[model samples]
Target: MTGDGPGVTLAESGEFAVIDRLVAGRRQPPWVPLGPGDDAAVIACPDGRTVVSTDMLVEDRHFRLDWSSPHDVGRKAIAQNAADIEAMGGRATAFVVGFAAPGHTITAHAVDLADGMWHEADLMGAGIVGGDLVSGPQWVVSVTALGDLGGRTPVRRNGARPGDVVALIGDLGRSHAGYELWRNGIEQFDELRRRHLVPHPPYGQGEVAARTGATSMTDVSDGLLADLGHIASASEVSVDVSLDLLAADLDAVAAAGAVVNADVRQWVLGGGEDHALVATFPTDPPPGWRRIGRVLDHPGSQPRVTVDRVPWHGTAGWESFRVD
Candidate 1:
């Protein structure tokens, strides 16, 4: 499809001018020492340790222009990266973006993408401090998020103990349901389809968990079981997720499952990109998070992740360079 107006393709506007159009007039937070128009941004970290994570979304692999607009792609990129910082039990402070796209792409689409990025960042009370724009064969959006510790120690994946309880906050299976709806061309579940375009992460909840003495934490960017497997291996503990506890999550997407002839349980078990927060707590989980499992004291022979005492057979998580 052609651009919005002026027929200004990448060849006509060039990279720098397109970036100027994209970043112009965007507001940044006070913690951002330096905003866009620089090589990199400088952000304040009063607590000493900064939490950072990066993710790359390649066109056709991560998203399709036909299935999602540029605006949706931008929001998804920022949301996913922000969730990583949240998983570290930190608050997102700022973000830096690296974007590559075909030289023939419309300048208007690029600007719209940046608009969506800024909008999502504002929701988290963060800033898109800096970014780079370059030409490539297709769109490749990479985002790196920096976060603040807020004087609380970062909750890591390896910190779970034997008796800790597993908890989850945020809806599961929605994005996967959306994907199924889109793939099957089913238009019934608008909410699920929209969720696939832009995820709504549980903002500020990560820092809350950190302050509340959470032991281990991770974002559900990958499938639930796959992500818990990371914690299990790192903490040298076994995790058992109860299907009964997850029935609510399954029921939430049950309608969409029926439309596509897919299993709701598979979506809840294997869906990724929901950006939900999962943590291990020593006591009862705080409000807004539901207890789904418990940590076990097994060593070498413990199951990485299990559902109702059985090993789950669905796909686990996402990877960059996989043929499957």
Candidate 2:
């Protein structure tokens, strides 16, 4: 009955056994009234509403098994989805995942992936309440996160106003820097390399921003400017980022950029996947958040994001359909 025994493949164990191994011995949070093993999960909605977000990760596009362990991939999947919920100024309460993998994949790897998901969910006091498993040509992980707003109005991208301060909580460009290092086969900068494999999102900061008077907010899943551009377009405003304010982040990745013969500014400005929360505030940002820029009015004009009062010419963050 040991799915991990003898290096069993998912096909060898069949679907039910593989799923059993993944869900076995896992604990659920109090908010999750019903978890896996039921037809559907029952999550508490004390506020009478739930904030939901979903993301899909395909092998070789979002991650590569050769570069990322099953554990790393699992964490990345959950972290990204959780960030979406956080962007709305909510705390994640539960998740429902859908996993597809080649039948030839090892069952142990699948279990490890589940463990990784649980690891991240635990960090946010959430639970992986339910999921589905299926066979495919490659690995595909799709996660849907449900969150609680705690009686606060859900922050939206269109709420940013002119003169609002732009602040961020979490690191930036480290993942892109890590990707560059991995592509060049450089073995140094262990932390940057690890960051590319699994992102570290600032958990609970979303609710803090909302309570602290955040007008608009988003996680830096795409590059900074690109994600901010979303707020600009939705809010009908322009954003100007100050390079002077981002000195610390640039310095953080400068060494890695030099080693990789890349521009550190591009990484900090345009790199994505750090899942950092960037928001617009009317007053002083809360403690632990760094002020980076300000929002501007753009009435009857196309919304834009700028750096140092000028448009940036570097890579504009990741696009789902862009070909290199």
Candidate 3:
């Protein structure tokens, strides 16, 4: 798309000028001793270690310009990366972004994208520390999230035991439902459609689960079964998710499913990008977490994830190289 009115294009304003506009008038959190405008950023790691994760989003593949605004795309990029840190039982403190777009793109769109990143970062009291901007064939957003563990041990995916309770904190299937709605060109279910554009991960709940003695944890960025399979494989355990426990989630998307002529169960089980935190706990999960399943011994059996003790035969989750 071409620029209009007084808003300049990236090619017109040049890279440095555009970067200045993106960083101006933004406040960084106190933990971020130094923010943008430097060769690198300085963050405080009081616990002597830092949690880091990175994710990249490509235009039209991860998102669509027609389906999502630049701001929404920015938020999605930061949210997904931040969720990874949270899954490690830490709180995100800072983020560094790498943004690339065509020279013909509007500068205001880039500013809007930065605004969305800041908006989500502020939700967890994190700061946008530093980043780079460049010209590319399409919009590409890459974010690196830095987190603090607050003296708690990092919760890994291999710690789950046979008796651990599988629990989750955040909604499931909404983003997938939204994607279907958007794909079908249905304008209804505005909330689901919006959720597909921007995910609302339980930000501080990761540290809460860690404090509650969670054995293992991961964010449901790829479908529930696919992500749970990660925990199962790592812990060398079999995970059986109960459909009875997921009735509410199924019900939540039933209407949208009908509108799109899709299966709500598949959405809840195999759909991804919701970014919900799923964990296995030895004791009762944190207050907001919902119990969905349990871990089992994997003696002589392959590490796998099942629903109600049955193997699921559907699209497991997103794969990077899959050709549809």
RMSD of every candidate to native, in Å, equals 2.1, 0.9, 1.9
Candidate 1 lDDT tens digits, 122-167: 8999999888888899999999999998888889999999889999
Q: Which tens-of-lDDT digit does each residue in 1-324 have in candidate 2? A: 546776889989998888788888989999888999979989999999999999999999999999999999999999999999999999999999999999889889999899999999999989999999999999999999999999999999999999999999999999999999999999999999999999999999999999999999999999999999999999999999999999988998898899889989999999999999999999999999999999998877789999998999998789999998
Model 2 stretches astray by more than 4 angstroms: none
TM-score: which candidate is best? 2
lDDT scores in order: 0.88, 0.94, 0.93
Ranking by lDDT: 2, 3, 1
Model 1 lDDT at residue 55: 96
TM-score of each: 0.96, 0.98, 0.98
Instruction: List runs of model 3 lying over 4 Å from the truth.
Output: 1-5
Least accurate 10 contiguous residues by lDDT in model 2: 1-10
Give per-residue CA lDDT, model 3, range 102-161, as digits (tens).
Answer: 998988889889999999998999999999999999999999999999999999999999
For candidate 2, the per-residue lDDT at 249 reads: 87
Model 2, residue 256: C-alpha shift (Å) = 0.9
In terms of lDDT, model 2 sits at: 0.94
